[model samples]
Target: MTDRLTIRRPDDWHLHLRDGEMLKAVLPETTRHFARAIIMPNLVPPVVTAADAADYRDRIMWAKPKNSDFKPLMTLYLTEDTEVRDVRAAAEIGLIHALKLYPAGATTNSQSGVRDFKKVTRVLETMAQIGLPLCVHGEVTNPEVDIFDREAAFIERVLDPIRREIPELRVVMEHITTKDGVDYVAGGGDTIAGTITVHHLVINRNHILAGGIRPHYYCLPVAKREEHRIALRAAATSGDPTFFLGTDSAPHTDAAKLQPCGCAGCFTAPNGLSILAQVFEEDGALDRLEGFVSEYGPRFYRLPLNDGTVTLEKGPPVEYPAQIETGDGPVTVFDPGMPLYWRVVD
Candidate 1:
C-alpha cells in the first residue's frame, strides 16, 4: 500500500471533447478531476476562426455538468489561410487560451490544418506580439516519411524554423514522443514547453502490438520505441516546468476503433489522473508528481494556479469500465487493465 498525499488541483493541459452528445457524455469525467483543460480544436470542420472558437466554447460551457467550474480554455485551429487578425482578436477577447498548429493531414480532422508553416509567418508574428502560445501537433505528413519518423523530422524541418522566426512565441510541443522531442523541449530556453501524455509515459509502440493490434492504445504522434518511452518518463517527472501533463485524451467510438482501419485517439479522461499517479509512483517520483500535474503548465501559460487541492490515496486498484455507450455505438476508453494503485478520494 502507498501513503496518501494532497496536491494542488491539476489541470489537464491537453484534452479533446468531441461535440454534441459525445461532448456531454465524456466531459463530466474530466471536469470532476481537472481544474482546467486546454480544449483541442480539431472538430469535423475545425475551429479555425474566432467566431467558431467562441461558438464552441459556449457549447462546452453549456454541456458542462451542473455546478462544475471546469474551465475549458479554447484554442484556435490553424489553417494555411488563418488570418493574423483572427488570431489577435481571439486572444484579445480572451476566447483563445492558446493557438493550435496542426500540419495538414497530420491527424484526425487535421485535414483542414495549415499546409505551410512559413505562409503563416505574419499570423505567428502577431501571436508573438500578443503573447498567445502556439500549441502544436508536431508531426510532418509527407507520404515518403516513415510514420514513426514524422515527429522527429518535423522538429528539424518545421518547428525549428518557426522557433527561429517567432523568437518570442511561447510554444507547447503537444504530445511529445521521442528522445529528440524530449531533448528539444527540455533544452530549449524558457519559452519552449511540451505536454507529455500518460500513454507515452507508461507504454511504447510494442505495448500497442503486444498480443495483437491494440487500437485503443493508438493515437497520432504515435507511440515510439521503449527507449523513447523511458525518455518521456524522465521528461515528465524531471520536475521541469517545460515538461507537464496533457492527456491528449481524445476519444472515438468502439465501432470506429475496432474497424479494419480504426481511428486515432484514446479516451483517457476518466482514468487519466489515476494512471498518471501510478506512473509517477513507479518512477519513484511521487514527490515530483504534483509539479508535473498541477504546477508547471499554469506557470508556463501565466495563469493563476487553482487554490483547491485533491487527494489521491494509495488504496484498492480502480477498475475502469471497458466501454461506454455512445449515440452511434459503444466507445472504448483507454484502460491499462491492471490494479491501478492510486485512486482519487472523495
Candidate 2:
C-alpha cells in the first residue's frame, strides 16, 4: 500500500451513463473508479416518476459488473407535472435518491426538464418534508442572459427563491463552472452545496477554442475564464464538504462531437478520477484530496463512508485512451490521449 496518500473510497455525486450499450460501455469506468455514484436521470424520455426511477434502478443494477458492490444512487428528473405524491412515495421506498432540477432546454436531453419552478413548488416543498436533495443544473434559459452568467443569474433568480421558500431543503448546484456559483454556494454557507467537474477544473472556454473548436471540451454551464477556473480550484480543494466531485460525465459519439455543430458534453469517466487526482496534486492539495473525494460527499448526502479504498499512485505517467469501443461506434474519451501522472491502482 502506498503511504503517499490513503483514504476512504470516493463516491461521485453527479454522473450520466446513458441507456443500453452506452451504459454498459461506460459503467465500468465509473464502477472501477468510484465506489458509488449518484446517476443522472436525463435520459431520452427521462426518469420522471417513482415507477420509472425504480425500473431504471433495476436496469442499472442489471448492468453492474457481476458481483460488484458498485451502488448506483438513482435520481428523478423533475418536470412540471411531476407529482408530489410520486416524489414522496419514491423517497419513502428509497427508490429515488434525489430530485434533479434541470431548467427546460438547459442541457442534453433536458428538454423534458421543469418548465416552471413555481409550478413545481409543491413538489419541492414535499421533497423538503421528505428530506430529499434537489440537484439543480443551475442555469437560466433566457435568450438575453450571457451564456457564462446564467449560473450566477440562476442562483439569484431561481435557486435563491427555492432555497428561501424551503430553507431546510438540501440543494446541490450541479457541475458548477463560475465564480458566481462558488460564491453563491459559499454564501448559502452550509445547506447549499455544489459539484465541480474535472473538465471545468482543467479547461476554460479558451480551451474550447484552443487549437480549434474543441467540442468535446464543451458542456453546459460552459467553462469560464482562468480566474474562475482558479476560483473553482480553491473552492474544490478547500476541504469544504460543500464542494464534491461530480464528473457530469455525459458521453457523445465522435460523430456527434465532431459535427459542424457538435453536442455539448465530455466523456471524462475513462479518465475522470485520474484527472481529479492530477488536479489536486498540482495544486499542492494532495493531503486535502481524500476529504474532498471521499469524506465530504458522503457527509453531505448522509451516506455511510465506504469500507474499501481505491488507490492512485505516483509512478510512470499513464496515457488515457483516445476512444472506447461502443456498440454504435467508438466514443472519443475526454482529455483523450493525454499523459498524466495519476493512474488509479487496479
lDDT, candidate 2, 128-175, per-residue tens: 777799999999999899998998889889999889888989899988
Error of 2 at 293 (Å): 1.2
User: Candidate 1 on 38-114: residue-level lDDT in tens?
Assistant: 99999988998999998999999999989988899999888788888878877887888888999988998888888
Off by over 4 Å in 1: none
User: Candidate 1 lDDT (Cα, whole model)?
Assistant: 0.88
Query: Among these predicted structures, which one has the highest TM-score?
Result: 1
lDDT of 2: 0.85
TM-score of each: 0.97, 0.96
Name model 2 segments beyond 4 Å from true. 1-3, 336-338
Report the alpha-carbon TM-score of model 2 versus the true structure.
0.96
- For candidate 1, give the lDDT of residue 94: 84
Q: lDDT (CA) for every model shown?
A: 0.88, 0.85
